[model samples]
Target: MKRTEVSFDIETIPLTIRQFINGATIYDSSCSEHAKTLFVSGSERAFLKISKRGTLEREYHMTKFLHQHNVAPNAIAYESDLDYDYLFTEAVSGEDGTAELHLENPRKLACVFGEYLKMLHSLPIEGCPYGNRTHELLNDAQINGIDLNMLNEFSYSAIDNVVIHGDYCLPNIIMDHFSFKGFIDLGYGGVGDRHYDIYWGIWTLNYNLKTDTYRDIFLDAYGRSNIDDDGLNYFTKLNKLTD
Candidate 1:
């Protein structure tokens, strides 16, 4: 991969010993055409996230949208460059869901994740303007010479128009201890099939843990029965091939 260097100044923030332990070096390598990086300064306790996208306009729009809906990290500061089309924002405190949770019970974690998905799916999708991820995924498979027979076996039964985080994996979910704090990576966020998000969530766990027990927990919490097992199997197989 070609690395793009961003010309910018580093801003320092105060932190304690505990904060120093948890901070990480944050970078923004989002756009395909341009490279932008955000260097977050702090320890693991608390830090900031500076991002550079393809355009500052898009980032501003997204930031405003997330803030209006109360769905994004706190925006403490921002800067834009018209010539470079770069934008930056502060990072929020919390660990991605992919990190181990301190839950006394695994089932409880699944239930909490299920409920979180439900809440996300409940968001109104009338004016969503993002890409259709299901179509994109299927298209990418074809373009990459991946077999879609597995995906074809699944049924698109429920096409509920809901706001879906295009990348619905554990890493995108942030948690404070065992409780859900918020979500990240909204660049691909938009309205789409509820199953698209649900299926991916289950698939991620199955891939990482090589178990289906958590899948059942999520389904039960969603208050639904009779998931298209064949469909899930197909999508999972397709995901493996493409991934």
Candidate 2:
């Protein structure tokens, strides 16, 4: 299957803010043309996420699945049109957990984040209908003219299947202090090997910190003594070749 190139944006809808705030104000932030996120609060807080081309539907379904399993934030409402999709969910307290990590001790943050990934990987996957993504990703890479031999070195080993946040990065995590509150951006959520999450966790840490030490700390906290050298090699090669 050909992968669709999707983009994201966020926008604020014209909703009365006075009912919720003593001095109600509206703040809207857009990351891109197709994605917009709105924060509204005075007494009550909620987030309005708008996306184009059915992105919200995919995210909504994934969020609902996680909520059903008692994972994180609960969905409030969702609506869509031919051109846009909207999802409203209870706002998580605190800012992006990554922001906190960057300013303070990242090693400790890595430990906490590592444990969260382990817990996430422990979720049951017997009933999930998603495809085995390790294979699927490799397949997609190959179809896109990615080198197979360079990709095969990755562990690709199937640990007990569990739900994977396909894009498990720090910014996607919401937390207060060291305590993980919830997760967002589930467009790629599905069942897969634990390494899929682990691999990306390391990748994200490396990307965020511009250092490899935190990656080691994360692996240690994750109880992994040795990195999946093969997997890392393949993914590194894959990352370079794809770019």
Candidate 3:
């Protein structure tokens, strides 16, 4: 699998809009044009994640941290000139779960992904320095020009302990034929509640496969027989307030 998969030690080249718009192969899961990914040199060897100028810097910091921790792809370069933060990372050696072919065994895939989140949550949160309480999240949103109502009455406190994936979705996970390889798109990940990732994980499986068939199987595989409905609902409602 490693030999067959395209990999690269990509050079330090500043990605340009022309290359992104013209020659690069775009990823299907792109949230938007600014949030899109470009396979810069083709062959899936390298890709550049381009985002608006000043939204955040956690991807650069967190990707490098997780890569060093042997949980993500190695970042090739991170450039922020004026506007737009471009993150260049080497392609991981596997098919992302978003690939249509990998959808063959959605049950196994859900279980494996659930286990990955469990492993991620087991990691200690000590020294980790991202994510925040609801107030902090709302504050940051306001700073970023997001209009959010004052939800101060809500108990928006930190429920820290487990490390969360932030966006615990299908595409963020990389797997080498049912074996977990690494994680991607981890800007929002840090110390947080495990149930949050679990909720999102289940959501993603249901969403991506267009079925809720394996939600219970996924939770069972994660060894959580009793789900945290409160935390799940909490994060869901919080996302509505802030996003």
Candidate 4:
């Protein structure tokens, strides 16, 4: 996540959050156009995200759920008014995977990336509330008026269902010197096909590092025996339509 120093009008902020970050350093930590994320560094470190009301409900709940499993930052508070939603979360320790320190060593980055993904997939999903993401994605694409005839032609091969970090990109996976810390931006996370996360893992490495050389290494580290080529292709096409 990028954190360029920025400022906010204290008077315009909601009273609840305004009090939370009083006299704190603020930075624009947002990566998405739909929301404004401000990082606060005062006596307490926290992130406050402001977005259209009702838009942050899933992320708020998901963050709290993942925190119980010790894989995400603790959600501090969530509030909504007539105009917007505010979600505050404690800062997780460590830099995002895109930090120069991690990106410098592509080999180790890919290995740890794959290893951590496997660790996430190993998590039990007995109580996860969002377990129908594949159908939801297809439905959302249709709702957005994107044609899905191509996706209709192929059958997605089955894999053991496991917990998935819906957007498992380098920036969302936090780490400290190659050790896993936590995952953020979990609006899309839940019980889903493992290949969806794998597809993103491969995509992020290639997109951020500007090379596809580590795709095989990542797959190997994650264990090739568990992967299905057809499943990867299925999600690739699905993502294109959804995007």
Best by lDDT: 4
Per-residue lDDT tens digits for candidate 4, residues 120-217, read: 88888877878776667667888999887876566765343888888999999889988888999888887788899999999999998999999988
Output the better candidate (1/4) by lDDT. 4
Per-residue CA lDDT of model 2 for 58-155, tens digit only, reads: 67877877876776677777777667777777677765656844438778777777888887877777655464766676667778987677555566
Task: Give stretches of model 3 more than 4 Å off.
Answer: 1-31, 42-44, 131-135, 138-158, 225-227, 240-243
Q: Which parts of model 2 have CA positions greater than 4 angstroms off?
A: 1-25, 42-44, 127-129, 153-160, 225-228
What's the CA RMSD for each of the models?
7.5, 6.6, 5.9, 1.9
CA error at residue 234 for candidate 1, angstroms: 4.3
What ranges in model 4 sit over 4 Å off? 147-149, 157-160
lDDT of each: 0.57, 0.67, 0.69, 0.87
Range of the 10 consecutive residues with the lowest summed lDDT in candidate 1: 12-21
Ranking by TM-score: 4, 2, 3, 1
User: Cα deviation in Å at residue 6, candidate 4?
Assistant: 3.3
**Model 4's lDDT to the true fold?**
0.87
- Number of backbone-clashing residue pairs for each candidate, in the order shown: 9, 12, 1, 0
Worst 10 residues of 4 by lDDT: 151-160
TM-score of each: 0.65, 0.78, 0.75, 0.92
Question: Model 2 Cα RMSD, Å?
Answer: 6.6
lDDT of 3 by residue, 88-186 (tens): 777787877877667888888888887887778777666666745334555676787665444344454437667677888888888888788899888
